[model samples]
Target: MSRFITIKDIARKLDISVSTVSRALRDTYDVNRETREKVLAMANALNYRPNFNATGLVNRSSHNLAVILPFVTNYYFSAVITGIQEVAYQQDYNIILHITNDSPERERAIIKNLAASNLDGLLVAISSDADACAHFQQVIDSGVPIVFFDRVPDAIKTSKVMQDDYNGAFDAVEHLIGRGYQKIAHIGGPQGLGFTRKRKKGFLDALAKHGLPVNEEWIIHSGFSREDGEADALKLLKQKKRPDAIFAANDRKAIGALMALKKSGIKIGAQMGIIGFTNDPASTIVSPTLSTIAEPAFEIGKRSCELLLKHISKRNFIPEEVILPGTLIERESTLR
Candidate 1:
């Protein structure tokens, strides 16, 4: 293969030193803007690229951050990634993406195999419980800083960026109640997740504060999925004392429950009401637009990256929680 062009080539072509070419490429120092542009354009034309690994070796850094998550197709997570990308691009950092599909073993194995070094930090949004956090902790022990976003573990003493899931759930339930919804059933997320517990607490607390009897049969725990929503709604509707309203963990679930109820010719936003969290795009697309708690997913992702970058820049970075507040989106789903 033909030899790859380098800064040395640019220097030789421009009758300048290699150092000048390096600084020019970085647009640093007092290099003339025109010369810098020329060097950059030439490098692009020649397909010359800096070897990041070599730079990392020189700077004692990998210059790459990894973001680990369970799912990407979900609108909430996607928005978070968008936020991360925007911040990373601005900070001149590159990001690596990893997905575990909610498998604790897979999550552990991926972290174990990361081989460290070329990574500066980690942004983790876990799917499993704190019991499954050993794998995530392994990287931390190896000296790579981690900042979690969204679904974080309860035990890890690291900076976290997440929505106030408890408060968001509370607002959703309270809104339903405000609209005259009583006998409300809750379709919760997986029992293992931290956010799920927070959301469940919010749900139960809202009921208790209103003096509504906590019906054991009305609360169902399942995955954050449409099928789970459908199944839970069906189970509740079959009960002798069916709930007049449903509060789902996420918008997908809420939309699912709405579909199930609509299929049964049940009136939504009238005799029956449904509300959800996450503000998934499908919330508005559904027959009766869903009233949901909107998590600032992009802000969470962006803030997580910012925190991880801070830790990477300073080894002794103190950990803190960054809670992005959630908003309530009112629509037909919660109409009285």
Candidate 2:
């Protein structure tokens, strides 16, 4: 077996003391640039890497902020994470990730067991199953400050960062209505998510505003996934009178609806107008090029982190809800 290189090896090769080698490796002020460069070059050539877990005790208190979300596969969540990372890099804080996949029990378990003392703060985009706030409320009972983003629990009295989903959905539905689609359907997300309700309201409101009745049969509370969208779309299509258009809660569902329509020999766009929320990349690659509401995911992440930082500082920050506006991006799917 080969012997692993350490500071002692570098010091022995350089004819210097171990303390000097350590200082040089860490780029301390006492170490000269020449010596520091030599040590770094040698370390890199040897493929030496510092283990954060081992040296974290001597380093800062992990400088870590934990972010928990229901899922990470969606582009919206990915964009939000990018924003959180931007602030984390600027503020010199580490960001840890956790996912619960919308399971309420799992969400509770993760929150309950996390060492709040070790974490600087928490930024959460809760799961769809987060109907009761007892688990999150318990976090508040503890000392660690937290800020909820996107899929937050509205029932809880905490700082929340999300988009104006109602307005976004309203615009999409209204746009479809204006395009001469009188009977519009909504393939929504989980019934528990606040955004789902907001989107449903927008769909209904738009219909009512235009003197069209919101048939309860047309509204479906499916999960936020491609499969869910397909199933909901299938059920809607099988009804006595098929809806001319569908305004899905998110891009995944919208894409799913598109696939369902294609399989059933229904032409998208003018034949059956469709729009989705979240300008996910899939929206473009999918057939008919889905029109969508662009969520301010990156901004949501930055705002949530900033709000949590204020709470961490114990500055008597007031709890506030911030709803970032979304934009409408038209494409082939909803084109009339």
Candidate 3:
């Protein structure tokens, strides 16, 4: 069997002490620049790779992070993962992904089992049905730092990063109003999620600001799936007084609304308008396109990872909340 090259092998080849090679490889400030450069060159030539297991054994740090999310099939979640991976790669940390499929039971199982993984930290976007975050508290108390993003839970006291859902929803509604759509409706996500509540509040506030009637029936709460959107849209369109425009919580729901409206023989962008949050690629692909709010999903992921790293490095670091703004992208779906 071929043995892997180690720092000691590079040190011997360069006639230097193993400690010197170790410090040089880590780019420690105490090492001489020339010596560090020479050590790096020799290590590269010898294909020397540090044994992370040994390092972890000595330092009690696994240098690995866990990212638990509802799912990654959507553009927003996938893009967020990309952002997180980029930062993890740069920081020489490994990321372990766990998908809960939006099941609270599955999320609980994952969190409950994370204590044995020796993870340095955790970044999560909790499942919609997660009513309690006591499992997360157990993980935190066990010394694994956690930072949440996007679909964070209110019950958790950890750091969180997310887009400005309230402002995004407000902007989507106000834009629809500006386009001359009076009877506006909203298709929101599960009411339990923090972002969902924020978006709903924004929608309600915007309607009140414009003196529009608050039809409780017009605000439908459901899952964040296109199918959920379609179902809610059908219910609203079948009403005695149908809405003239719809503002969906996310692009997937918006596209679903479009499908329902098109099926009902309603002329989109003319007799009716549709707007959504999260500029998913499907938004542009759907016929007539989708006018919506573009969230900083990637930025949210990066910031969450950064915050978790901070907590990992400084155990006493106080938790913080970071909210990034979303931009409105006007498209053919809402054009007059």
lDDT of 1 by residue, 1-336 (tens): 567566777778777787877778666769999889888887777776454333442346667889889888889888999999999888768889999897777788788789587788999888664466777777898899999888888888999988999899999999999999989889998788888899999999999999988898998988788987888888888999989999899988888899998998889998789999988888989988999998898888888998998998788989989988899999998897
Using TM-score, give the best candidate's number: 3
Q: Tens digits of per-residue lDDT for model 2 on 230-306?
A: 99999998999889999999999999999999889999986899999999999999988999999988999999988
lDDT of 3 by residue, 1-336 (tens): 468776778878999998888878768789999999999899779765443554453346678899999999999999999999989888878899999999999999887777546789999988898878898888888888899999888887889999999999999999999999999999999888889999999999999999999899999999999999999999998899989999999999999989888988999999789999999988889998999999998898889889998998789999999999999999999986
Model 2 is weakest, by summed lDDT over 10 consecutive residues, at: 51-60
Worst lDDT window (10 residues) for model 1? 50-59
RMSD of each: 4.0, 6.5, 2.6
**Stronger candidate by TM-score (2 vs 3):** 3
- The TM-scores of all predictions, comma-separated, are 0.86, 0.81, 0.89
C-alpha positional error of residue 160 in candidate 1 after TM-score superposition, expressed in Å: 0.7
- Give Cα distance to truth, residue 169, candidate 2, Å: 0.8
Model 1 lDDT, full chain set = 0.85
Instruction: Report every candidate's CA lDDT.
Output: 0.85, 0.84, 0.89
Cα error, candidate 1, residue 284 (Å): 0.6
